[model samples]
Target: MTSYYTIDHLPGRTIQLDGQDYLFFSGTSYLGMAQHPAFQALLAEGMARYGTMFGSSRNGNLQLNIYGEAEAQLAAFARAEAALTLSSGMLAGQAVVNWLKAQGFGFIYGPKAHPAIWQDPSTSLPTVSFTDWTDQLPELVAAAATPNVVIALNSLDALCSVDYSFDWVNRLPDGQEVTLLVDDSHGFGVIGPEGSGVGALIPRRANVRLIVTASLAKAMGMPGGVIFADPETLRAIRHTAFFGACSPIPPAYLHAFGRAQALYRTAFERLQTNIARFENRIGLSDRFQHIPAYPVFYTEQDQLYSYLLANRILIYSFAYPTPADKPNTRIVISALHQPEDIEQLGDCLYGKTG
Candidate 1:
């Protein structure tokens, strides 16, 4: 039988459920900035400077400049020509899809692409057959007659246990230009130098146009979504009805985001250290390419969920944003997790007696 519990109280890495504290390993706040006093101070200061909400639409004549400032800062961090911020990462993905559809671009979706990219059933655009591997992408692109073809995928697919490599960018047949739309939601603020996302790992190429979108709510411990693209692309998107009609992210949050750069960098280092220790204790194989920021273990034989819960550890177990047939046990290690917590969880997973 399945049982349910609620978090009555939360204190950083630990949660109170059933009047007992349990170490949490299921949340996406990878850098642990959500509970940082310093980060909270910045948010409070922002709230003081800017009101709690900027309820006005972006299309309004009078608007706050904090939104533009935040977008510029994010663009510089992502090393892109320009950036746009939306209320949520899902909206950011939808904005991109809407732009592509408006531009008459056909899509070649990756097998493990996030549902947000193709969740809209009302879309009338054409889609090529889903390609499960990089080797099959070029032929599909070559066959498409559309002026622009988009290859949509996730930078790190934890569900399939695959980390995309840039080598595939070189394999695309010459003269067949394809745009890459990557949803790096899981990798942002977790991987790459200074948590710049997967774009930092892949060398920039002149042959392909790269566009990436991610949710700041994840590792960044902030709300909203950001899009990185060229100036022309961003400008075109900005002029769309979606951008003009939607409300901008709260001014105070954007102000806080602009000021939390240094904190994010510091937290990233600590998170990496915790990941390394956990991986060492668990003895992970080299073949597993999922990002260290997201420590997901795949097992069909072991009852690890019940085992961990019995030990007062909470983890996320579900098949979501992935094929329903394939489920994964996700253990998210954050910077807030203590060394002993990591060791204890590692010991539990490996059945090691300490």
Candidate 2:
């Protein structure tokens, strides 16, 4: 019965929950820019200029200016050659899957493929769940039913527990034009040498074509999603139903996006400090046992979720079961969270299973 609460404050890591406010270590507002005055002003100004809803595709409104600039800003921010903004992260994911399917290619995803990947209707492709992308060669070789293999993965919070290294990605079998769709929603502004997060992982590779997509709700603390890749691939994806049929995002949002993308590079160190501080303080070394992803605290999720809710503290739980994998929950962390919030969350979990 732990319901989510919203605050008048911008979408930062920490905020009010019900009448009680806690340092929000949850959700994807990794760098705390969501609540920054500049970011907030961008949204406010955009709203004043363009109103809330565009309500139509590029056809009627021709608001391509906002889109193009945002795409450019995001590409530079994400270190991608180009980018596409989608209505939602899930839609962006579905867009790629649908497009790949329509092209008659096979996709072998990590064992923990986001549920939407499997929901795709394209049947001519092969889809496999990879538990360990680097070590699961036998599984992939045995499972792949087609020559073309497309892999959709999250860099840090991988659906599978794959390491975020170009080394393994380079090890990908040759002669196959394997398109790698990496979801860096969580890593975009928080990790890596430059706070480029997952982008820090890609520049080293030459063999594979890479595509990055993510939801702004998580890290940049916005409400939409971004697709990053080359212009040709982006052009190809734009023709899909999810990309073409849907209405464009409001022009006002471009401000938040622009500010977030601008700040992501500078804010990486602060976010990393926040991450390291929280990790050092907590002693979950004894109680939790699930695949590790960034600063997320994962374990027997369902029961932990119910237990924490009954106790009044709230958290998100991830529970996609892989092949031969048992269900679990993940406790996602954010940069805006204060030291106190981590202590409270630690007490909650430590008290439960410890």
Candidate 2, superposed: residue stretches over 4 Å from native = 1-25, 59-61, 119-133, 138-145, 158-166, 203-207, 240-242, 260-267, 289-293, 301-312, 317-330, 343-354
Considering only N, C-alpha and C atoms within 3 Å, which residue pairs clash in candidate 2? 14-24, 28-218, 110-130, 111-129, 111-130
Query: What are the per-residue Cα lDDT tens digits for candidate 2 across 1-354?
Result: 233355676545545656665444345555666666777787888888778867777544355578788889878776778988877777777777778888777766554445444436442332442334557753574468877677766675433223455566656665556777777766666555565557657744455678777776666666777777889988988866667787666667876676555566555555566556556655457445423335566554457666776565556654344335454455666655666666777677554323
Best by lDDT: 1
Instruction: State the local distance difference test value for candidate 2.
Output: 0.63
Q: What is the lDDT of residue 248 in candidate 1?
A: 76
Candidate 1 per-residue C-alpha lDDT over 127-230 given as tens digits, one digit per residue, 9 for 90 to 100 = 43333467777787888979678888888765534466767777776786778898988888776677788787665667688899898888877778888899
**Each candidate's TM vs. the true structure?**
0.90, 0.77
Off by over 4 Å in 1: 122-132, 284-294, 319-327, 351-354
Local distance difference test scores for all models: 0.76, 0.63
